[model samples]
Target: MDVELKSLTGNGTWSVVSLPKDKKPVGCKWVYKIKRNPDGTVERFKARLVAKGFTQQEGVDFIDTFSPVAKLVTVKLLLALAATQKWSLTQMDVTNAFLHGDLEEEIYMSLPPGYTDTSSGSLPPRPVSSNDTAAEEALKILLRSHFKIKDLGPLKFFLGLEIARSSQGISVSQRKYCLELISDTGLIGSKPVTVPLDPNVSSHKETGPTLVDLTPYRALVGPHMKAAQRVVRYLKSNPGQGLFYSVNSDMQLKAFGDADWAQCPETRRSVSGFCVFLGSSLISWKAKKQHTVSRSSTEAEYRALANTTCCAPDKGGEKDCGADFSKGHDRFKSSERCLLLDGDDVAYTEWF
Candidate 1:
């Protein structure tokens, strides 16, 4: 806690201020956590001062909220491209992520619990800069000037996913995360299952009996507690199982899409899914319920196709994304990649 407070104060994140008239201040508390390694050994202890942002009124305290974060799909795609190019992947951490951004609204936060300061603190705006790095030294010097940065050497564990690079390719898995999840549910000693869930047991929102004790059910799973447990058991069978991006990939894009029309009993909405492959390496994929109900299977399939096209890599950002395909038109600009729907009833038309 002392280290955390010192860092915050050193960064000049907030300054002592008196509460203004006709204004409400949000409270803050210290959050502690033990960060562990993949071997289940304690790596370090962390403490963070978190503001009770939930207490603030939406329109008054803040008009909009935005957090700059890289999507999982983007990570995978970058890894795939890096593996193909045989590029080195380095991991880095910002000393204080919260210090990088500036708050537009004039908001006040009460002093943390253990602090002796009686006056409230107002967060001051900070500057952020962007520049292209021509060399390694230039990049480091540029970053160090603006914020405190720490280099963790090579990429390994991030966001619960373990990463490994080899001559064959890079492999990513959630082995440690899987074990922790299983242990939390008290299923460490449970027998492993071949399947995640039984296909014969069809689940419906209105068909199942109401659970009298919702506490345990909600803790384990939203609706299907038993099925969710089985998924954990299946995960235990091969916790180290993960996706591999091969170095010998040909850098060709292949997409596959499918849909289940009227699968949801209550909403009658179609469930659609699609997966895109960059030369045998699966880069992006999603399975989601459609926003609106589709009357025919053809409509559902086309909707799935449309969703896949938008999510797939585009030529505009071809530097990071290897695939050279257009975003809006029904046809891809590159002849090598396309979303082709084959059926007599289906007509090829430009629809975003």
Candidate 2:
């Protein structure tokens, strides 16, 4: 591929018939990945030839690159709907998804080695003596061709989420991802904790000196985030993991809120959290820091409740109106078990 690319440039497939003055070509590199099945099986090898987007100037090379994605709530709602309606779930993936996007900007890239234009025949390594406009046009045309691309239809496995469908519903799991996470964290050999976090402890930010060795910290966090992404992948892995609506149950949306006071040592900021359930399924959850400083545990809990009341879906009634879940406070009743876990008890909440 590199050879063909080099030859194409020399023969005017990339540059003009003559060399252009002043224009510099951006570099590119080869990227590789191993596709895997959800069942911890090897699928196939994949490769990508990508431009060195890092080298491109922000404003000059590209602009307005933002893309919208479905919200987490939206995703959960869709899943619930699928489960309820018993919809058939199918996953399709576009091969070389990024390549399918058309380049709107006039971008010039360095010729990759081993790629050549067959129509240009053979050409000596002679400099192209041409104007910049002609050279740019030739380069663009060459880019459009020479690169052999194909789409690998459908998605069997993506981001470690294994998806399977049945008459009961769609099942989404990250058993493989979880294994990888356990391996990466060296937790496979370690005993499993009953919960991901300690309910008894709290965190706080310290003004102490920073650590000199940051590599280990970075490595730890990297896998942590990968695990979290795996959770999202699990949600997207199956379209059926969502809400399963039924006519038998009452349409009541219940939310629970909690907080850990002065969770962060450094900032002394509390961590507030909440989760909402539609029927028996968990539809939404959030763990975040409080905006203002809280004076006491009661105040922190009150703030968290207030935040949840505002954010959670309004199931308009006198029982759900009060913005507090104090001890012994009995406002709303639900026949189903509550899915909300106290945020302070979970170790993962500290990261939030």
Candidate 3:
């Protein structure tokens, strides 16, 4: 706790202050965690002094608060692209992520420096990683000169996702996370399934039951709980099974998607999912039920097709995703990529 306070003081997080006319000081507490390596071993002990931000009133302590969080999908997509490029992912400790956002809110620095001063904010710890050797080493030099920092080595357990590297490619899985979820829900002895969801389960459309004791685990409640349990059972069956991205320059992107029209009798909305591949390895995949209902099966298939075009570009930003198609998609400026629909309902006048 003493060390945490000293670090906060060193970072210029706050100053010794007296309570204002009707205001109170926010309380803080030290949080400890056992940081571990990728091989399920203890790496180090971490201590962080976090403020009780939840106790603050809306307009009393601050107006608004915003924290940036990285999505799991983006992480996998980047790893897939890295495998294709034959680049390894390494971790980097950044001093401040909200260097620009701190100017608007006074939640960071004790002293309000001039407009030119950019290093006043007390941004949260960023465990970001990169593949570029030059840029990463350059950043380390910059952080060392300004703040007291330490290197945590190669990327391991990040945001609850385990990363494994090899000569062939990188493998990512949520095995530990899945196990913890199963143990929390007391489903260790449950039977395994080949897939996550049951196709014949019609109760998914209606509210089955409410789990009064286990509401925090949303996946373990109501009709969703059964499907969630099935997913956990499947994870238990193949805990080591993960996305294996191989090193190759194929760069050819292939997309496959399907839609079940009016799949949910509860909502009448269609379900669509797509997986984009960079050569033989699958890079990204997502399943989502449409917000709006589709009248016809073709419309649902077309909606799924629309999602395929946007998935690679939105998720895989740094890569030359657009170049994969080359002249194959030249004529498809308005709505690019060829669409292949399943079943016999392949009737479209404008396209195909």
Candidate 4:
């Protein structure tokens, strides 16, 4: 507690100012969590002072909330390149990164324990952890010169994901996080399934009991929380399994896309998912519901293909063909360094 407070004070997060006549400063609370290692070991205990952002009125207390964050695809892309080039991937942590950044707009806080506005959901080494070893090192020095950062040494646990390095390649997983999720939802010792979603339980969703609680379904959560639990169970079964970027993996970029036509019972929107690979290294993948309903399967497939192509931006080089494609709502394409996809949206494979 003292350490956390000292760090906050040293960083100039907020000062104990005199209470104004009319200002009602927002209240703050301390949040705590236990960090664990990939092998189910306790890593460290963390405590954070957070303000009740819910109480603050938008456009009054704060104008706009824009958090600069990196997509998961970026992480996968870096991992893929590291695997192909056999580069050493290290992870660093900025204890209070958001507190250091210069905000565009100004906002004042009330008395008592003043609050520091948070930036994003989680930290995943955005603008860091790239393939270029020397460039990355240079960046580290520059960052150290500016902000107070701790070199954790070798990327191990990051944003709930566990990373392990070996002679063959680097492996990444979220086993610890999955188990915690299962425990949180009270699904311990439950039978695991092969897929993330259980088809039988989710089938015939025309009449399902509505969950009244709204907090549970914030993110990766829903009305029943069953889907989240099911995903946790699936992850439990393959706790140690994760992306394996091999040392011998080639740099050939390829992508695949597909979609489930009108699969959602509640929403008529079709589902699109896709995955991209560099040689044999799986770099990125996405699965999401379509915005609009497609009239025909071909139309849905084409939309998915267009999405894939857009995502598979050219990495400033020529790509060549690497994978075979099949008919009926499936597409493939490749970029110089990345591959693009749509509903059931993914891979459009034509190597430049």
Over the stretch 144-232, how does candidate 4's per-residue lDDT look in tens digits?
99877677777777666677888888888877776667777666888888898766776444445666865655655543466776777
Instruction: Give the candidate number with the greatest lDDT.
Output: 1
Candidate models: Cα lDDT each: 0.72, 0.49, 0.61, 0.64
Clashes of 3: 0
Clashing residue pairs in candidate 1 (N, C-alpha, C atoms within 3 angstroms): none
**C-alpha lDDT (0 to 100) for residue 229 of candidate 1:** 77
- The numbered model that scores best in TM-score is 1
Better of 2 and 4 by lDDT: 4
- What's model 4's lDDT at 127? 30
Question: What is the RMSD of candidate 2?
Answer: 14.6
lDDT, candidate 1, 65-132, per-residue tens: 87666678777878887788776666656677656578777778888877753211212112111222
Candidate 2 deviant stretches above 4 angstroms: 1-19, 71-73, 100-102, 118-159, 201-213, 222-253, 295-352
Question: Taking the tens digit of each residue's C-alpha lDDT, what string does model 2 give over 1-352?
Answer: 4443443344443342333576666787766666565665677665445678888777777776864454556445444444554443333332233344465676677655444442112111111112244664564456447533232222234334454545565455555756665566454445444334444643223323465766644655522343333333443333233234342322345667778889777778898888876555566788998998888777787777667767655423223322222222111212112213333331122212
- Tens-place lDDT per residue, model 3, 111-185, is 221112212223433444556788878888887787665575667656777778888887778777777777777
Better of 1 and 2 by lDDT: 1
Model 1 has an lDDT value of: 0.72
Task: Write the number of the candidate with greater TM-score, choosing between 3 and 4.
Answer: 3
